[model samples]
Structure formats: C-alpha cells, structure tokens
Target: MKWIRARLADGNDEKGSACAPGAFHALLEDDRVLPVRGDPYNGHERTGEILRLDDVRLDVPVVPPTFYCVGLNYTKHIATEGLKIPDKPDVGYRANNALIAHGEDVIMPADATKVHYEGELVVVIGKRARSLSPDEARGCVLGYTMGNDVSERNWQKSDRTFWRAKNTDTFKPMGPWIDTDVDIENMETVVKVNGRESTRFHTNDMLFGIDTFISTMSRYLTLYPGDILWMGTDGHSPDLADGDVVEVSLTGLGTLRNRFVRER
Candidate 1:
C-alpha cells in the first residue's frame, strides 16, 4: 500500500486544514486515492470516498516528530568526496522545517553558489522501539519514501554544523507517497537534473545499512511512530541553478521532483 497525505486540488481550504480528518489517504491501483480514517502506523480505515489521483495535491507524507539522517553511508559517495569511511554507523538530525512535498520549489539562498541534490531513501518508522537488534529494526519500519537532501556546498564547508546549509526551509523535498512494500536489497536510485540523468547507484550500496542505523540509534534513544530516517545518497550532484528541476526515483517507489529557484 502507498500512503499519502493530500488535499483536494479545487482550492478549497488549500492552506488551512492540512491535518484535518480524512486528509490521509491510500493510493489505489486504479489510479484513485481513498481517504482513510487513520494513519499508516495505527491502521487506515477506509473512508469509502475515492477520488482520481489527479484531483489531489500531494503533501509531505508525514509531519515527522523527529527527522533523522545517516551521514557518509554510501561508499561511492565517500570515495567521490575523497573522505574516509567511518567505522561505525552514526545518526544525525535534520529539521522538519526543511521538508517540502513533491512539486514544491527549493528556494536557493541568495548567497548560496553551489547548491546540490542528494537523492536518498527515507525510512518511515511505524512502531515505537528501543534497544532493537539489527534483525528487529526492519519490523519497526512502516515503509519507504524518497527524499532530496538539498545542500549548499559553501555553507556546508564553512560552517561547523549543517544548521543552515542543510536545514534551510524547502531544502528537503520528500514524498510522492510512502510505499509499504519495498525490496530494499534490489532497489536502485536514479537522479536527474532538468530531464538529464546525472547520478545513479544501487540504493542498498551503503557502508552502513538501515538496520545498522536503527539498531545503533535505538541503543541510546527511542524510535517512535512518524519519525523518519533518511538513508544517505550515493555519488555527487552538479551545481544546481535557478529553474533547474531535479527528479529522484527509487525502484518500485515513486519519483520526487522539485525545482530550484533563486530566493527573491
């Protein structure tokens, strides 16, 4: 099942009522979306109202309580950056404010000269867990989604932390929807800039996989429903410019596309 959070596109309560009841939905096989009574973690009771997929606007799949990230997980990406691979799985945090939905514009800061996209697989947690074993970690995940970890290279290098460089508003474009079933081991990631493919890699080609990150983080902190972990991307992105469109596609999962625009 693919879960989505969206609103009717007829301009009624467009900005307001994002979290209103019946906003959560399930994408049906017949190209329709069915509003559900509850979320994916708890259980989704059908609302019996089905609408054409084209009649709705997609929103961020979920408003995550915690945004987690795994850094330097991809070996190829690390090698491309000329950095040493870490021995242990390390988890980082990202701000929720940076998250935007598919079709949104990623606003490039006026001072940012080297903006890049990191296409990644986002793990959506469904069950509360702590001290999980590597094998148990997989059971806690509800599904997977795609995310674009947009970064400003200049600030990323100059600043001690990625506070602004990575957490800037609209920097993270996630969602077409979350796929409850995914073959992670067989997945592949392809990234395109303005209709041209720029980066491609095996999605599971990580130095540290999802199970490691979850188990490592769960040892110290609890993983809760609605929290998300962004598995890092592979390879590098070219310097993005104004009006450039980026599309991130994961096998079986859908594509997440966003345009970069200069901040006015």
Candidate 2:
C-alpha cells in the first residue's frame, strides 16, 4: 500500500485535523490520498475524512528522526565516471532542512553553477533497528520512495565536508508517497531534465544494497523509525540551470518532479 502525509485542501487548520501540518497518514486510492485516521507509525486505522489527491498538498512524507545517505553505491554509476569502487559503502548525512516535496522548486544559488542531480531510491525505516544482520535489515524497512540529491559540484570539490555542496536548502526532493511493496532487486531509476532523458539504471545495481548500509550503520548507531536512507544515484547529470524541470522516476514509485529557479 502507498502511504502519504498531507493536509486537506479545505480542512480546518486545527492540529490533528486534515488541514493541520503534515497532519496525518493517507492511503492512496484512485487518484486520492485517503487520510488514515490512526497512528501510521503503528497501525493503518482510519480515523477521519478522506482527501482527494488533487485537494491536498504533499509534504515530506515523514519528519525523519535521522536522514542518512550513501554515495557511489551503484557499480555502474561509479564505473561510468571511472571512479574507484570502495571496499565498503561510504555513508553520509543530509540535512532534513534541505528536504522538499514533489513539485517544489529546487533553488539554484545565483553565485553557484555546475549544479547536478542524482536520482536515487530512498529507504524509509519502519521499525527501530540495531546491529541487524543483512537478512534482518529488510524486515525493518517500512517502504521505499524516490529522491533527487541535488548537488553543487564546485562547492563539493572545495569543501572537506559536503555542507553547502549537498546540504543546501531544497537539495533533497523526495516523496509523492512510500510504497510498502516493492522488489528492491528489480527496481529501475530513470531521470529526466526538461523532457530529455539524462540518466537511467537498475536500483539493485548498487555496489552495496540496503542490507549492507543498515547493518553497517546499526553496528555504530541505532536506526529509528522514520529514518530515511537515500540509496544514492546512478549515471550522470548535465549541469542544471534556472527553469529546468527534473523528474526522477523509480519504477513502481511515483515520479518526483521539481522545477529549478535561480535564487534572486
């Protein structure tokens, strides 16, 4: 089942209502995200009214407890650039403040150029996990979603840490909804810019899959519910500019489309 966090277009602004801030979980049904009344973190009980998909605005699916990401996880993605393959998965942290929902604008700082897009499959943790084995990792996942890891290449090359390069506000575009049922090994990622295809690769082409990252990270720190793990991207993207529309399509996962605008 596909799940979303949204507010009703015309509901009351009161907390816990359909109009409240990222108010509640909604199940997708025939062009609508019907609000699931109960605690989505625990159960899928229907609590209140249903909202049509067009009648509600999408929000970052969940307020993640921690936002984790991996880089160069895809073999083809790394090999394409002739980059060295790492012996182990390289993990990174992204700012939740940078996250934007589908249809939001990704700001391109006027002084910065060489901005790029990395279309990735994102993992949403459903249960608390610690020191999990690779086999146990799958059970902890609630669902999968899509993400666009927007980067500023120049800043990336100069900064020791990817602060401004990767954590710039509006850098991460994820959502539309999370799919509870997907074959991780069979998903494909396709990226487009201004209607032109820029990148495409299989989701499972990763040098290290979800199991590796979860197990590895869990060994050092606890992974909590609502934590998001971006599985990284494959292929390359041309430098993005103002007025560009980027669409990241991950097979069964809905497309996450966002426009780019120069920060004036």
Candidate 3:
C-alpha cells in the first residue's frame, strides 16, 4: 500500500491519503484508499473528498519524531571523492527538526559559498523497534522515500563535526510519496540537477544494507513509527543552486522534484 501526506487547501492542515506510487499498484488492501474495520495503524481511507494528488501540495510522508542518517554507507560514494573506507558504519551526524517536505524549496544560505545535493535512500519506520537484530530490521521499515541530503560544503568541510553543514532550514527535500513493499534491490538511485543527470547509484552496492543499518542503529536507539533512517547515497552526488530544479528517482517508486532558491 502506498501512503502520502498532502497539504490541504487551508495551507495549514495535512490529510494523509491513499494512492498508487505507480499505475501498476493495487489500492484494494490500502487502508488509505479503502476503509476497513479496526485498522492496525488506525489509518482511515479518506479519498475523493480530499483534492486530487495533482492538485494538493505534497509534504514529507512522516513528521518523524527522529531522523537517523548514515554516512558513507555506499562504496561508490566513497570512491567518488577518493575517500578511505571505514570498517564500521559511520553513525555520527544527524538532521532533525529542519527537514523540508517534497515540492518545498531548499533554501540556499545567503552567507554560504556553495551548497551541494546528496541523493539518498531513506527508510520510514512503521513499527516501533528497539535493540533489534540486523536480521529483523527490514520488518520495522514502514517504507522508503527519496531525499537529497543538501549540505553547505563550505560549512561541512570547515569542521570535523557536521551539525552546521546539514541543518540549514529547507535543506532537506522529502517526498513525492512513501512507497511500501518495494524491492530496493538493483533499484537506481538517480539524482538530476536542472534537468541534467548528476549522479547514478544502485541500491545493490550498499556496503551495509538496510537489515544491517536497522540492526546497528536499534542497538543504540529506539526506532518508532514515523522514524526515518536514511541509507547513504552512491557515487559523486552533485550540487544544486538557486533557480535549479532537482529530481531524485528510485525504481518501483516514482520521482521526487524540488526547486532551490537563495535566501534573502
């Protein structure tokens, strides 16, 4: 079942709805499309009364209580910048609170010299999990969404710590929608800046896969519904600037697009 969050006409309220990520998906089992008694998540099928998807503004799929992201989980990305490989997962660095939704503009900091886009595969947690085994991590995943880990390269490389580099308001571009039950294997994680392809990465090359990522993080924190774990990106992810159109696409799921503009 595919789930989406859309901003209502009021411009302040959001209504979750049911929709197919692609034309091939079935909405019958989707509680967001059709109602069923005593749904597990209490998700109601509130379709039609709400405006059509093309009409309503899209937002991030989940207002996550936490956003846990990994660094250098993909080998291709490591090789792209001529960086050394680390033995264990790079579990430091995070971006919370300032995550921007899909179709939202990514603000380019006025003082910043350069801001680059890092396209990645992010997991949306549906089940609450704590200290789960690596083998059990995939089950906790609610689904997946496309994200661009927008960063100020000037700020990022300035210091060893990454907090400042990742959190400028509107730096994160989330959505088009969250796709459930996807086979991420061999899927293309592509990034395009201003209609030109910038980076191409495959899910198959993830050095530490989703199962490993979930299991690893669960040992340290509790994974709850609406929690997000962004799997690292692959090879030479590119940069975006003011007036640029950015699109990230993953196979099975559709493409997510956003615009970037300089902050006044």
Highest-scoring model, lDDT: 1
* Ranked candidates (TM-score, high to low): 1, 2, 3
Tens digit per residue, CA lDDT, model 1, 133-202: 9999998998999999999988988999999999999999999898989999999999999999999999
Clash count (model 1, backbone only): 0
lDDT of each: 0.89, 0.85, 0.71
How do the candidates rank by lDDT, highest first? 1, 2, 3
Better of 1 and 2 by lDDT: 1
TM-scores for all candidates: the values are 0.94, 0.93, 0.84
Q: What is the lDDT of candidate 1?
A: 0.89
lDDT of 2 by residue, 32-133 (tens): 667775645777667557656877778878779899999888777678657788998768889988999998899988878889999999999999889999
Between prediction 1 and prediction 3, the one with superior TM-score is: 1
What tens digits encode model 3's per-residue C-alpha lDDT throughout 104-125? 7877878877777888888888
Identify the runs in model 3 with alpha carbons over 4 angstroms from their true place. Answer: 10-50
Work out how many backbone clashes candidate 3 has: 0
